[model samples]
Target: MNRKIIITGTTCTGKTTLGKKLAKEFLIKQIDLDDIHFLSNWIEKENTAFVKDVNSEIEKHLEWIVTGSYQTLLKDTVWQEGTLIVWLDYPLNLILRRYFIRTYRRVFLKERCCGENYETLKSTFSSESLFLWIFKTYWHRKRRMHHWKNTLFSHKEWLILKHPKEEQKLRNLLYDN
Candidate 1:
């Protein structure tokens, strides 16, 4: 398809899963920004360096699916070049539930996430916890995406999948092509 796709949303919105599935189906490269933005030691990459590296990597591929909410890092490059922007606008409660489950698995089961970061009770309960982060940013993210949908990215091809049925329809449509 040679499509440059971006799947973005707040934490725990299934961006990575959808990106992986689409990339696999289309035989294109897939990148999760978190994987390249955070180091193994959990230190974040410098903003300039992160932007440069991500831009370089994406520029190397003609077709790619990049999943993450890094508008600051990618706006001029990947985001601008995207053929389709998939915004997952799930409900706040659903996002909270998903985040809780994901964090629980990571913290209790010691599951590794992007950047090789693992969740711990101490960390999960701390201000840095994904759960707390989601609570703080979910509404803000939704508002931002809504703004983009109406103004900034209005002319671009976009999909706002708010429910499982819509997501399934999107999947079917993509797979059909």
Candidate 2:
């Protein structure tokens, strides 16, 4: 079967970057879960609608690499259909630094995702902030992956990439294999 990859990790762990890369390498479409979940002004879509849309996308795409860490609504669908789950487990310091830098860049440049733009420093530091979310969920995500790595899903192929070198190695392996 052709692989359907799900790239998931804590916020700012380069899932999007690596997903895009893998998609390009394999010539598959890349789906950003953020694009489906966020609406104008950074508001989250309703859970029911969000799940429906995600399910629709998963069904519509023949082969894809979807990237996100939104487990509350979309995890079950992704885990069920994804042939390989690539977990980007980077250090907290690295994630924190990337979170701040990416947030600053997006805010300063007025870059928008899912029709939302960063409008204020307070918005960037609040409970809703990706930075804080990453810090809050880092260990919990790690633990969940640890548990997941031993389940039926564990028997499926999983690549836990921790560093740039390992990521490159996995990329090479994916292409070679």
Using TM-score as the measure, the top candidate is 1
Off-target runs (Cα >4 Å) in candidate 1 are none
Tens-place lDDT per residue, model 2, 105-166, is 78787766654645467788677777767768899999988788787477668888896568
- TM-score per prediction, in order, is 0.92, 0.91
| Candidate 1 residue pairs in backbone clash | none
| lDDT, candidate 2, at 115 | 42
Q: Between which residue pairs do clashes occur in model 2?
A: none
Candidate 1 minimal-lDDT segment of 10 residues: 168-177
Candidate 2 steric clashes:
0
- Model 2: residues with Cα > 4 Å off, grouped in runs: none
